[model samples]
Target: MTKPAPPGKAVREIVPGDSRWAELTHSDNHRFAIVPDRFVLPRKGHQVVAALQDAVDDRLEVSCRSGGHCGEDFIGAPRRNLVLDLCGLNRIAATDDGQRIRVEPGATVGEVQKALFRDWGTALPLGACSAVGMGGLVAGGGYGPLSRQLGLVADHLAAVEIAVVDEGRKVRAVTARADDDGELGELFWAHTGGGGGNFGIVTAYEFRSPAHLRSGGRILPKAAGGLNVQKIIYPWAMLDEATFATLVGRFFAWHEEHDRAGTPEASLFATFFLHHKSAQFLQLMVQSDADIDVGGAILAEFVAGLTEGTAVFGIPRGGLMTWLTGTRYMSQADCGDVMGARSASKSAYHRSAPTGDQLAVLYRHLTSDHPGQASYVMVNSYGGEINRRGSAATASPQRDSTAKSSWFTAWLDPAQDDLQIGWLRAAYEEFFAATGGVPVSGAATDGCYINYPDVDLKDARHNRSTATWHDLYYGANYERLRRAKRAWDPHDVFHHSLSIEL
Candidate 1:
């Protein structure tokens, strides 16, 4: 008989016929509903060690899931049936007078944000999706509205606690921290943006922003007193080809020029939702902390500049709202049950505005409507203080990017998957055709975002670039990441499709 969990602890093994099997095996993408032989849900770090050891003993391929938000089948790794669902390990703690925060892998973004603000008056640059887990997010370099001002969540990662299976097939735990310059430090650096499921199963993280270290207080980043948000829509019906081109061109130029290391523009962040014509209106959303935006003048002037020489116009903004309320509102924009929504996403890091040809491609796609699918192109403000640190400082190397983008499409019908996926690929390929069907790091594009993994980049059928898949995701940091992988995961205990190869 298997050893039982320790007293006051609960660990469950779910199988195909178990009552909670579907829940445990479900993926957010729904493209691949993995039917693992079993899933082990553990509530503590020790339990993770035991579960991984069991999987290794059984000779079962292993994979891990934090929030199941990855749009691909990486959690299943296509065929790995022994899944380690970390959702039950959720725990959040703050110590050293709230200056040192430790978050368990399974904690949700919303839960972490609430805890940080409620007790410490601190915040981290996390994604907008509240239910997204911190494990994969932090591992993939967390980015959000606050990122332009505060930098990536991984940028402040002080330490990582992980469980690994050694060559002896015995599981062991190790704590790697940033302050150390030894082997452990390299492991810690790998987690900063190396993407999860590569090195090992992370159990916990210690967050200490540079500001926190320098001042010995104020964990993460300072919480803004309030936030001023403006959501404006541009009716596609009123926009001509020339006007649409101008609107997008200006938006890109603005972010590129303002994305400096240290500047007041860092206080402002924006996202352009260029939805397909089926969605009626394309939207522009901009936000800033009230502490840096007095009387909303910064937002007003910025909007005005965006609309200059275009048919678009800025809408009047309302007064500021408390940080909690504003963040909640921000979360609401992306919250909901995305659980069985069949979706696909491709990301690009733009060092410069899309050329006129690229803008034409965007305009063409936005005007044409697909009957069975939904699609949109999102351009998000990136690179302010995020650019302050060089590429070698962390595994996330897109430090010189001006803006980041996501070409997305979603559908509910199983039959519509082909339609929606093809729609996104066409748009994405055409927009990046100049770079050989992928965003190869260069003068115009800075490769892809690891957080938004697209296996298509690895398929020669789609990607015509000479650059390998690793080149697009890790850029110049690929070699260092490979070395880190070899040093840490010798037996390849933890791995996925895009994980650094040993």
Candidate 2:
């Protein structure tokens, strides 16, 4: 592990041979990582501005990295870019009134959760993976198991402090808040779900709970009764074609029926992980904040809906644990572990369940021969309190979506890259053939999640849909985000392949 740089200051230098330099260049995804000429480690907000100014003065390209868990190569510049390493800015503190919390961009979700719960007995609806940095996650409309009841992490954002490049390419630190009257408020709106490394380098974020939500033991949602999680596994070998189809159909139908803002089942969240046929099993994990009495009932009802003709291998019950303990367990550490693997992913915000043909396509591809070593189709319940707000309320416009489907496949060796990537692409295209090879925003498909950040949407070959990249990602909110970008980052200092185009 790299030691923390000194506090209340920043460090900028070139370390082409340092072990940490090599490690920092690469992230959770090994598919991309172009080395930079220098690494700028900023310890504080002022230091972040100074580092940006230095990079601009040197005429070097710039990028920022917090947790380095991005699926794309936003931080992995392909040229002599100056990368701002923000890991040294980890800080979490609350306002004097205790109603708002200030979190530095480098603070991971785990750190934020622990601090919020320990200090105030409250929590934020952040990503399930603790390793995820607040910079990208919150900016990309983060959510976790608690999202169904609490809503997206971005919904809680009160203000954001960012260092942007001015017209002369000089660095300027600007604070945008939700309550700001003019352009500053719009700038803050863009950060709600504009995706990271786009508008500027964010140094810190302030999160505030709504007045109505101030009474709960936990700021976001009540976990006083404890949480119950259940994992049900069904071996694919035991599942006949009918059983498989029925299970998938039932899972989709359940969400369609109950995925409203407030409902009895709204607190119950479930995820279906459908691995390749060769993997021989599908897993459905469900969790709820309800206590043992109603928790068991909720889990039983959800399982019963999908077990019509299916034979399950086992249904393991997860023990009850306090909100803090359960959160600690849910924070995944595998995000940045290995870096040699190559993978391709595609995401969709489903407004409706998959059609019969779509389901058939998924089944055929899962069982087909493919070079990819591991592949899975994960469908997570979306909507609930997340949809309580309107599409234009934030930069993330997939509020009406009831479910999110993610198609992913991974493999080792550059030799298998084409095969694995091709396999995932084919699967996604076929699944949405009715939508012109992409999940176009409409009655059935409400576009894709920006957090997933699929560059494939930019290519005409992959996105045959009438809607373009901006349309699918931002919907009607694209123009607003564009304005924010032009105003704050006229020179387009912070950018990526799929960033908000000027």
Candidate 3:
């Protein structure tokens, strides 16, 4: 029999036939699901420690879930059936000095933002997805619209609390602070971009911007004013192959010039959503936290340049809104409940603009007559303050990349999985055909983002890149991460498919 949980903490057991079992096994990408031998939910850190101890005693493989947004099957292990649902541990609060904020793993990015703004009138540069949990996002080096101005969400980390098992097989909780010495310091650095669910199960994180320290507590960084957002759409019917390619080149050229470290234009952030030809239209969204007029002018200038020769379907307008309100506007698209649709995503990091040949391949795929599948390639502007830090400063080494691109597709039918999955993979493979079927760390591209995990990196059939998956994701920091993993999780209690190996 399994040991009982500590006092004041309850552990609910879920069997295969229970109604909750089906729901619990489901993940963000319904493409993969697993029926575990045991399932438990812990509401607090001590309970998590107790659960890990129990798992160790029984020699059971374990895994954890926060927001369940993993695009791959990392959260779903076939033999590892011991899963911990942390939703019950949701909590958010600010430190007494008003400089650092403490957030629980279960708390969504939306929840953390609201709490930070409400308690201290400050915010962190996190992903736009409202439902992404702090656990995976922060550990994977999160970035969003504000990242160009401030930096990665991981750059602001002050400390982290995690649960692990010791060599003697005893359950224990450890806190690793940025100011700590030796192993603790390494542990903290590993979480900066090493990716979550590797070293241990994270319980809480403390974050504070470096600019806050520079100000001597007078003012926070990049939050002095509100934000201005501009959303523009162009019907695909109006965009011929030449015009689409022209606009794409123009967009790339503009970002190459503006998204430099310490430049005034660095405050301007934009994302070009190029949907498949079947979607009927392409959308370009720009956001700036600067003065409304300055932001509007910048947006207007960029839009004007992109559509100089071609006729734009609808000339969009710029609107000014508070940070909270702007986030609400951005979050509107994903406001609904988490659907159980099968999903797949592939990501790439580019140091320069896409080559003419690459753009042509994209056009061919978008216009191809394939199954009516829903998919899109999102090109998000990267670099600015994010590039000021050197590769060795954090586990995230893609600091020099100018753009982060992701190919995402979703559907409800299992029968069409091959058609949709093949479409996504073919596009990615063709894009990096020059680099042996992957984005190798070089002048044109700098590997892929760890946050956008892709298991294909480990498969020889798909990953033809000369560099290994660790090199693509961690660059020179892979050894450091592996060492830290060996030190903290020698028992390999917390791990997944792409986890750091001892």
Best by lDDT: 1
Model 2 gets an lDDT of 0.80
Candidate with maximal TM-score: 1
Clashes of each: 0, 0, 0
lDDT of each: 0.83, 0.80, 0.81
Give the higher-lDDT candidate: 1 or 3: 1
Deviating ranges (above 4 Å) for candidate 1: 1-9, 96-99, 212-216, 314-319, 332-339
| Residue 64, model 2, lDDT | 85
| Candidate 2 local lDDT, 12-69, one digit each (tens) | 4546776667777677787886587777777778888887887789877888889887
Candidates sorted by lDDT, best first: 1, 3, 2
Candidate 1: tens digits of C-alpha lDDT, residues 1-502: 2334568769877776666777666677877777778777888899898888888898788898988888778887667768889998788997556557899989999998899889878888888888889999999988998888889999989889999877687889999988878778889889888898898899999988886323325666778889988878787777888888888888889888888755677888888888888887788878888887887788878878766866666444444788987887766334333445778999999999998999998888777768522578889999898988999899999899989998888777889878888888888888888878899999989888888999999998789989999988888888988888888788887877788999
Q: What is the lDDT of residue 365 in candidate 3?
A: 87
lDDT tens per residue, model 3, 331-446? 52343322778878888888888889999998888878865336888888888889989998888988888888988877788997998889889998998999978899999899
Candidate 3 ranges beyond 4 A from true positions? 1-7, 96-99, 212-224, 292-295, 313-318, 332-338
Alpha-carbon deviation at 261 in model 2, angstroms: 1.9
- TM values, all candidates: 0.95, 0.94, 0.94
- Residue pairs with colliding backbones in model 3 are none
